[model samples]
Target: METLANLESFVRSADHGSFSEAARRLALTPAAVSRNVAMLERNLGVRLFHRSTRKLTLTEAGEAFRNAISGSLSDIQAAIAGAANGGGEPTGVLKVSLAPTFGTMHILPLLPAFIARYRGVRPEWHFENRQVDIIAEGYDAAIGGGFDLSPGVVARTLAPAHIIAVSSPAYLAGRKLPAGPADLAELDGIVMRSLQSGRIRHWTMRDAAGEQIPAPLREVFVFNDPAAMRRSALLGLGVAMLAVPDVIDDLESGALIRVAPRWYADAGAISIYFASRTLLPGKTRAFIDYIVDAFKQRRLAERFAGSLG
Candidate 1:
C-alpha cells in the first residue's frame, strides 16, 4: 500500500507542475519527492505525469487522479490539523500572495494589529505582479485583481480597481491639457506590460455620464513594474493610467495631478482570495475578517473609485 508520504508527494508535484517546487513546499529534497512519486506510480500501475525538459504536464490519469483527490486531501489535512490543535487557537504558517505596491501600501500596515491579535499564526507572504495559482502554489490566500476563479476558491471585494490618467504637474506645465480621452494621444504616455501575459494592455475610459471613450495612448516609456511607471511619470516623462489607490498619496500631496479628471477606466475589483472550505482554517478566517474590516473602516472602496473632485 502507498504511504501518506507517497500520496502527498504525488499531489503536491501535480499541483506545482514540478518536483522542485513541490519539494520546496513539502520541505523535502527534489530527488526525494521524485522517488516517492515514482514509487507511487509503480504501486498504482499507472503513469501520472508527462515529463519534458521544458515543463511538466499532467497525463489523463494524472488529471483524473487530481480531480478525484485534491479537495479530499485538503479536507483531510484540515481535519488532522484541527484535531491536533483540539479546536483551540489557530496555529501554523499562513501563506499569502499579494501585489507588491498595493500590498506594501495597504495590507502590510494591518499586520501589526493582526499579529498582536493572533499570536499563533505565522505569516509567509510574497509580493509580485502576476496571478498565482493559489492552490497549486500552496498559498492560504491571495490578494489581486483579474485572477481566474478556480474551483473551491472564494473571493471578497476589497476595493474598486478604478484606473485614471495621471502625470506630474511639471509635464503638463507648457502642454495643452487633454479635453477628452482622445486628446491624450497628443501627449507622451507611460504604460505597463502585463507580467503574466507579456501584453501591452489598453483601456476604454468612462466619462462622468458613463460613456466609453477610446484612449489611443502614445507610449513614451513602457515598464513591467507599476511603481517604476509611476516614478517615471513623476520625473515628467509622460502620463500613465494607474489604479487610484496606487497614486492617492501623490494626488493629495501635489506630486501627481489628474490629466482627465472626469474620466476613469473601470478595471475591476481588488479581491481577497481563499479556499472555500466548510471548515476553514482559523488563520485564514482571521485574515479575511481583519482585511474586510479594515476596508470598511477606511472606506477604501469609495476612495478607490477615482471620482472627480
Candidate 2:
C-alpha cells in the first residue's frame, strides 16, 4: 500500500494543503490523493492533516514528516532537472492563472505557439478578475497586475504595464475640460473600483516641466473590472481611469481620449510569476522566455508612448 508514488502525493498534499488542489497539480483525482495520504498515514501510524470540505491542516507528525522530506525531495527535483537538461525529456502539465484583461488580450493570443512547439507540454489556464493564491490554488505560474506572492513562491516581470486617465468626449462636453493636472479637481468621472481601495487611484499627470503631479478624484461611477469601466466610459457615463492596454483600441478609434498628457503612469513592471526554480519543466521556462523576449521585441514602452518619449 505504501509506495513512492503515494509518498509523492502526500508531499504534494502537505505542500498545497488541499487534496483536491494537489490532485489538480498532479493531474490525478482527489480520490487518488486521499487514498495515497491514507496509505501514508497507515504506514507511518499517524495522521498528517486535518481534512474538511473547506480546509486542510497538518498535524504534529505530518509537520515533522514534511521537515524531513521536503528538502530531500527538493534535491531530488534538482537532480531530475539536471539529468533532464543533460539528455532526458521534460514532460509535464503546466498550470497558469492570469487576470482577465491581460490573459485575454496578451497571454491567450500568444499561447498557441507554446503548445505547438512543445510536444510534451500540456497547459491548463485559469483566467479571473479576482486575485489568486498561487500555491494554495496549485498553479505552476501566473500573469496578472498585482504582485503579492507568498513567501515560498517567487515571481518575475513579464512586461511594464502603463495606465492612462481616460474619458468619453461626450462627458467632456460643456464641462470646461481640464487644461492640466491641477484642473482635474473640478472634473468628475467614472472610477475603477480596484483603484479606490480606501482612497481614489488619483490621476497622475505631468507639468510642462515634466514633474509628476496627482489629480484628485470626484467620481460618481465606480467599478473594479476594467472592462466594465471601459463599457461605462464608452456609453458616455463618466470619465474613467484605466490601464492603457484596456483602452488601446478605443483610443485608436477615437472612442476614449486622453484626459491629460501627464496622467500616464507606468504601473509597476509585471512579468511572469511562478514558484521557485526547482522542478521547473522546459515548457514553463521556454514559454516564459518566449513571452519576455516577445514583449521586449515589441518595445512595450515605445508602443505605450510613455510621457511622449
Candidate 3:
C-alpha cells in the first residue's frame, strides 16, 4: 500500500525540483525523502523521475501520474485537515504576497483586527513588486493589479487602479502647470519602467467627456518601482503618474498636488487572487471573506476612483 507519506514526498520533490528542497519544505532529511520516493516507485513498479547529478526531471509516466493525482491529493488533504480541526476554525500559516506600499498603508492596519478574530490563523506575508506564481511558490494568496489569471486561480476586485499625474509643491512652484495631457511635454517627467520588458510605460489620460489624449512626457528620471517613483516626485525631481491609492495620503497632506486634474488613466482593477480549489484551507477561506467584506465596508473602490477636483 502506498502511504500518504510516500505520495507527499513524491509530490513535494517534483514541485520543488529537488529532493533536498522538498525535504526542507517537509522538514525531513534528503535521504528520508529519497527513501519515501523509492518506496513509492517500488510499490507502483515504475520509475517516476529521471535523476541526474545536476537535475531531476519527471518522466512521461511521472508527469501523467502527477497530473492525475495532484488535484485529488489537495482535496484529500483539505478534507483530512478539515476533519482534524473539527470544522471549527482555521489553524495554519497563510502565506500571501502583497505590494509593498499599498499593502503596508492599507492591509497592514487590518492585521491587528484579523489576528484578534482568528487567533488560530497565522499570516506569513511577503511584500514585493513582482508577480508571483502562487501554486508553484506555495503562496495562499496575492494582492496586486494587472496580474495574468493563471489556471486554477481566482481573483476578486478590491478597487479600481486609477492613475493620475502628480508633482511636489516645490517642483511646481515656479513651473507652469499642465493644462492638458499634451502640456506635460514641457515638464520634467519621472517615469516607471517595466521590470519584465525593460521599457518605459506610456499613458493615455482620459477626461470626463471621454476624450483620451496621449501624455507627452519628457522622461528625466526612470524607476522600476512605483514606490521609488513616488519618492522621487516627493523630492521635487519631476512629475510622475501614480495610482490614487499610493498618493492619496500625500495629496491630502499637501505633499503632492495633482498636475492635470481633468485627466486620469484607467490602469485596471487592483485585486486579490487565490487558488480556485473546491476544498480551500479554512485560513485561506477566512482571509478571502474578511478582505472582501472589509473592502466593501470601507468603500475603498470609490475612494480609489480618480475623481477630478
Report the number of the highest-lDDT candidate. Answer: 3
Which structure is stronger by lDDT: 1 or 3?
A: 3
As for candidate 1, its clashing pairs are none
Question: Which TM-score value belongs to model 1?
Answer: 0.86
- TM-score of each predicted structure versus truth: 0.86, 0.76, 0.91
Give the RMSD in angstroms, all C-alphas superposed, for model 2. Answer: 4.2
Give the per-residue lDDT digits (tens) of candidate 3, residues 1-309.
678889989999998889999998888999999999999999898899999998888999899899888887788777887788798988899899999999999899999999899999989999998999897788999998999998668899999898999999999997888899999999999998999899999899998899999997887998899999999999999999999999999999999999998899999999999987889888988998899899899988888888554
User: What lDDT, from 0 to 1, does candidate 3 have?
Assistant: 0.91
Candidate 3, poorest ten consecutive residues by summed lDDT: 300-309
- The local distance difference test score of each candidate is 0.88, 0.73, 0.91
Order of all candidates by TM-score, from best down to worst? Answer: 3, 1, 2
Per-residue lDDT of candidate 2, residues 127-238 (tens digit): 8776677655667678876677765567776555667778888988888877766677677667765543645465575543667777665777776677888898899887
The runs of at least 3 residues in candidate 2 whose Cα sits more than 4 Å from the true structure, single-residue gaps closed, are 1-3, 16-56, 59-61, 64-92, 195-213, 305-309
What lDDT does candidate 3 reach at residue 117? 95
Report the number of the highest-TM-score candidate: 3
What's the distance in Å from true for residue 215, model 3? 1.9
